[model samples]
Target: MTAARVGVVTFPGTLDDQDAARAVRLAGGEAVPLWHADHDLKGVDAVFLPGGFSYGDYLRCGAISRFAPLMDELIPAARAGLPVLGTCNGFQILCEAHLLPGALTRNASLHYVCRDQRVAVESASTAWTGDFTVGQEIVLPVKHGEGRYVASEETLDALEANGQIVFRYAGGNPNGAMRDIAGISNEAGNVVGLMPHPEHAVEDLVGAPSTDGRGFFTSILSKLVNA
Candidate 1:
């Protein structure tokens, strides 16, 4: 079988591109590097927008990145059912692009947070979470100053009703995000965005005791293979 090719996008100030690519490779997939200024996607099977302070987080996180040339191609592809996973600032970008609902704002304490966070998988049917079981608990690192997820009441209701709320912070709400939403997926379930850094936790040798993050990459591989 041919290895599924997953693209890891690198925008200026993107800190986690290499890690995301490595995660893909470790998951038995080919990792394709993508640049924010580039307009092409290299025909990859899936796309990952890793955590970062793109454009230096100047005009709000992911505000400028939403207009990157790379997004022009990515947005359409995602809407057309290409699997897309956005982590941390990437999560902010998805919302800025309107591909995913809600916005990430400053942490309620107005401080940067870095910790291993516990999250419950609320929806395992999405492309990036198929390896997880619904109600499963996993630990992933969360590092960001603006990771608070917020949305309109109507949107939150719709997400809950449609099972689009993919992950919720467990134990405690680290960012004070509304309803403890750590991650969410689109109505079609192909596009997902989250504040946790799964790529950073893919390997046990990297100081992450658990390889819970590997599932995100492997889940996509399974989806591609099955499709």
Candidate 2:
């Protein structure tokens, strides 16, 4: 059978596109390279927005990248259940596109943070997290200056009630995100965005801190295979 094809998007300054693609490949899927300027999705099974300073971060995080030509096609596809995932700056773009809720602001410390972060899976029902179980803690790398997630109290409560909250900081709140939210899914659970870089932790041979991140790719591949 043909392997699941996952699209890894590259915006200008997108530093993690290759890493994300490698994770998909390692998870037994085919990684398809996508450019920000491309107007089509190339018929991939799922889409991944990798982390980086898109548009030089001239505007607030993903504000500019939100208008990328590719996003014009992506937004609707994601809404139609294409299964999309994002990390760090990719998470910011997902919010700007309104594909996911909440916004990532500057870390409370007012400094960039880079470290191995332990995140507990709060909801494994989403496409990208199905391999995990509730309360399972996985370590992934996080590197960002603006990583604090903020949303309205009502929104947070609703997310909690609907099981849309995906991951939460395990050891401690790394960025003062509301309710310690590290990641979340949309109402339908097809789209997900997180502050940590799962792509960075999928390989341990290169001295990566953990191989836990590989599950994100595998989870989505499983979903595609069964769909």
TM-score of every prediction relative to native:
0.99, 0.98
Pairs of colliding residues, candidate 1: none
RMSD of each: 0.7, 0.8
Instruction: Report clash pairs, candidate 2.
Output: none
Candidate 1 per-residue lDDT, tens place, 1-227, comes to 99999999999999999999999999999999999999999999999999989999999999999999999999999999999999998999999999999899999999899999999999999999999999999999999999999999999999999999999999999989999999999999999999999998888798375779999999999999989
lDDT of 2 by residue, 141-218 (tens): 889999999999999999999999999998988888999999999999999999999998887795267889988988
Off by over 4 Å in 2: none
lDDT for each candidate structure: 0.95, 0.93
Off by over 4 Å in 1: none
